[model samples]
Target chain A: MNGKYRILLPVLSLTVLLAAVFYLQPRAMSYFGLNLLFNLAVPIALATIAQMMIIMVNDIDLSVGTFVSFVACVTATFLNDAPLIGVAILLASILAYAAIGALIHIRQLPAIVVTLGMSFVWGGLAVLLLPSPGGAAPAWIRTVMTVKPPLVPMAVVACILIAGLTHLLIMRSSTGTLLRAVGGNAQAVARSGWSVTKLKAGAYALAGVFGVLAGVCLVGLTTSADANIALRYTLLSIAGVILGGGEFTGGRVSPVGAVLGALTLALAGSFLSFMRLSPDWQIGAQGAILILVLAVRLIFSRRGRKWKGAENG
Target chain B: MNTKAKLLGAAALVAVTLPGHAVADTADKRIALSNNYAGNSWRQAMLESWAKVGDKAVEDGVVAAADAFTTSENQATEQAAQIQNMILQGYDAIVVNAASPTALNGAIKEACDAGITVVSFDGIVTEPCAWRIAVDFKEMGRQQVEYLAGRLPDGGNLLEIRGLAGVFVDDEIHAGIEEGVAEFPKFKIVGSVHGDWAQDVAQKAVAGVLPSLPEISGVVTQGGDGYGAAQAIKAAGRDMPIIVMGNRQDEMKWWAEARDENGYETLSLSIAPGVGTLALWVAQQVLDGAEVPKDLTVPFLKVTQDTLDETLAATPEGSVANVEYSQEDAKSVIAAAK
Candidate 1:
């Protein structure tokens, strides 16, 4: 496969999905229609980016979903009533993520086991904070999430901003290169006198930052928080990363592609709803669409490899 | 009039007094509640009601212990595992609010095979061995349409806000609404959307679909979506339609405000969260060797226009209106089922 063209896969898939959605529901072409269609995309994109950061270091954070829910609960409850304490707690959570990363590196612990355990911790905290799904989102966050810009919807604008900023941070910067190197060949990087522990910890801290943003944006859009609100996001984020040309073990990831993959996923749900599929088959249909997209990507990559082989021959 | 006749009379007397004495037999039995999810206000209220009633029952010596355990994830496999744990813990009876109607049947059957009384409610299992305490969700949906038909005699276009798709409750209620429309030929369903039984999701769905829908005369909903429909319709600057509500406190509060402002009228109905307690007592009764039928029906809670204020006052803010059933109520329900 052509390394330079890898990012096009997510963009192509996203464009195809957008076209299908607009074709099926012409009303969705309008600004209001587009807003409603993609209103929930921002948080998903942020979560995907967060997952991408963890994947970049060849470590998965299984607790990303519940951690996001925890942040959302805090954002809606303490953040709404007592802003200072909420901010402090959020900062402490980020530090905690960094500490976990350091601990994993120091003790040679399995990332999956540690994170799987942490998921329950975060989930329990969220439930304790808000036993029920009733907490007011801070007024400013709600306004910002619902704000209408000039032409495109806020969802689109947010997606673009997230893509661009994450791309710069993860793909275009020296620090990001070091982070990826830590995943790619930690021994080599460590032999060169670069502190692998700090880089891995930094990667986790960055993920925590994105996870917080995802939760805040989610609560802003939903206007309330629930302990189970973003539980689906764990799988969704992993899917988005993979759909966006990310590998499981490699440090290879695309921030822009991850954002587009999230957008595509969000649009896929709307497209199915617009198609008016039978309720019995709706969830199955969603799985089918995912399979179809991944299959297409597989075919494209295989064809690319063939072309490259022919050129080498 | 001899000794044989006198012995028959004494046996009749014992039988007549057995209702009150049966409670003593179940005093040593332990019951466990295996709930699938507690993420929403409705579920939170349900758990609270179980605690309130279960604690009292334990104190009154009706049961040895009534412990409640909820799975973190609302998955059938997780809940099935929880049920298996309860079985291993030696619970005499298991009360289940299952995640799936059929997925937990295996676990439920295992409990029954182990000689444990299994009473399933709300999200009831389909296992014949387990006693089911189910609300007629179909009737709940039909009643909403009936209320609308009464309000708008000349039925116009109606929008349907449904619960989570792929759920049995959603399908049953949708079928009932379809049946209601068929019965009232004048009424036509113009638009339908899945609300996932959450206010925010419903609000988003309604807002999205409202752009293309015609002027609706009424909105029929499953529980927990009335306020969302109202918000969406209001935001679109449409004339207020008669939207039947699920017995959510926010919905009732909004209805009350609308009524005070413009005399808005609608119907609200849902199964009380306290149905958990009813299932609890039913489990105890079965453990006490009461001949409880295999299936029992729980009455859905309804709030009419006249009773809206009263219901709203009784419901805590952000919670659903509920009724906690006493042991006597459970006995009556069992008798009614028989």
Candidate 2:
């Protein structure tokens, strides 16, 4: 399959979705309207990227949502009240993620089970940190998140920067190639004098960094954190990665695609609510759209592979 | 047949509570407050109120010890386990804000069989053996909508900011709003969104729909979303409509300021966080051999421009709108319930 085509497909679909929403509510095309619609997309995109990093190493992070939520709880409580302890805790949590990666590599355990177990642990810890949701986010963080730039929505600018930076790190760097190779063919990468476990651990650490950022951004927007605030992100992040041309195996992912996918889903909710559809059907509608996008991606990728095969033949 | 069973059930509960009644004069009685979910300010306020009242009771020799347990997961099974542990610890009474209406019935019945008094509030349980203390959230919703209906006499577009979807309180309140709207021919609900009972979420939701909605004359919101709705309206640079304020301190402040500045007249109502204190008093009463009723209905606190200043002054910083009730007031509520 053509590399450019893979990127174009999801981007094109996102454009179409955005256009439809803009057409339905013309006022949504404005900067303020878009800001309102995409205000919550930054954290979701970060979480999706975090999940994408795990997928890049052929491991799924079931705990990303809870981990992000835990970070949010920390951000609202200790981060606001006691900066030194909060920073230490945040750094420690990242280290813990790295350790989880090492543990999975050492034990040869399924990543799903380990992360699922960790989700409970992270959730419990978050509850302990902030039993109820009343804490405030740091003033600077809130200001950064709520800032409205001159032309485009602040969320769009943030997404562009996130995708650009992640793209450079994961798609353009040497370590990125090795990380993908670790998932693609670990034995071959190992035989080539690279430590597969180290690369995998690096991917998990990167995932942790993104998860922390996601939590911080979420707290900035929410101004308060509850243990279950981002519980839905577990599935949403997975869906965003898949919708953004990420695969379950072989460590295939696109940072730009993932951000666009997050934006698409966030806008879908706003679009539906703007249309005043019944809340009961809104969730079903979101599912239908997600399935439709995935199905289209499946068909396109399959056809692209067939065309490539024909050319090779 | 159902009526007869209910009567027998009531008699059985009375018989069960009678033992505690007999032992009311005991020097010390341990009480545990078990909450299913402690993820919101309301729950926090309830717990704080319990601590305040419970500590006073402890000092007064009304309770030997007062302990609070909460499940962060909001899981019914977790709450049930907590209740079981409370019973095992030989608590004289267990006050619960149930996670589920029916999930704790069996555990409550177990506590009941073990001669423990169970009092469930807010998200109450269905176990006939347990006493329920709560406000009519549905009626509150109805009244909010009715007030908006009165404002929009000719029937205008109303943006409805609902509470968390699939929640029992949300469902009841939504149903009541629907019923209230049915009574008012002029009221039209043009747009509805789930605020999840949070200010930020509510503001975002209202902002999203405001672009597509034709001029909304009023916004009917469940408590916690009222101030957010107003903020969304203000942010949109649209004319402020009749927004019913919630019980939040921020809402009271906004209401007072808006009224003083522009004479903005809107009704605000909320199930006070002090209800937990009422439950505490009721627990003390029950343990004191007062024969408290099996069920008690607390009224929602209403705030108008006239009452906004007082409400704001009464509520502490960062707290929700509330009404303080004394032990005598709780006794009156108990008597009224009977």
Score every model by TM-score: 0.52, 0.52
Give the per-residue lDDT digits (tens) of candidate 1, residues B178-219: 989988888999999999888999999999999999889999
- Cα lDDT, model 2, residue A97: 89
**Model 2: per-residue Cα lDDT over B66-123, one tens digit each:** 7776653565434554565465456898888876565456467667877888888887
Tell me, by lDDT, which candidate is best: 1
Query: Over all chains combined, what TM-score does candidate 1 have?
Result: 0.52
The DockQ for candidate 2, computed on C-alphas, is: 0.01
Give i-RMS (Å) per prediction.
16.7, 17.4
Candidate 2 chain A minimal-lDDT segment of 10 residues: A271-280
The per-model DockQ list reads: 0.01, 0.01
Tens digit of per-residue lDDT, candidate 1, span A139-215: 89978997889999898899999999988887789998999888889999999999989998999999999999999
Cα deviation in Å at residue B272, candidate 1? 11
Give the distance in Å from residue A279's predicted Cα in candidate 1 to where it truly belongs. Answer: 3.4
* The TM-score obtained for chain B of candidate 2 when compared with the true chain B: 0.81
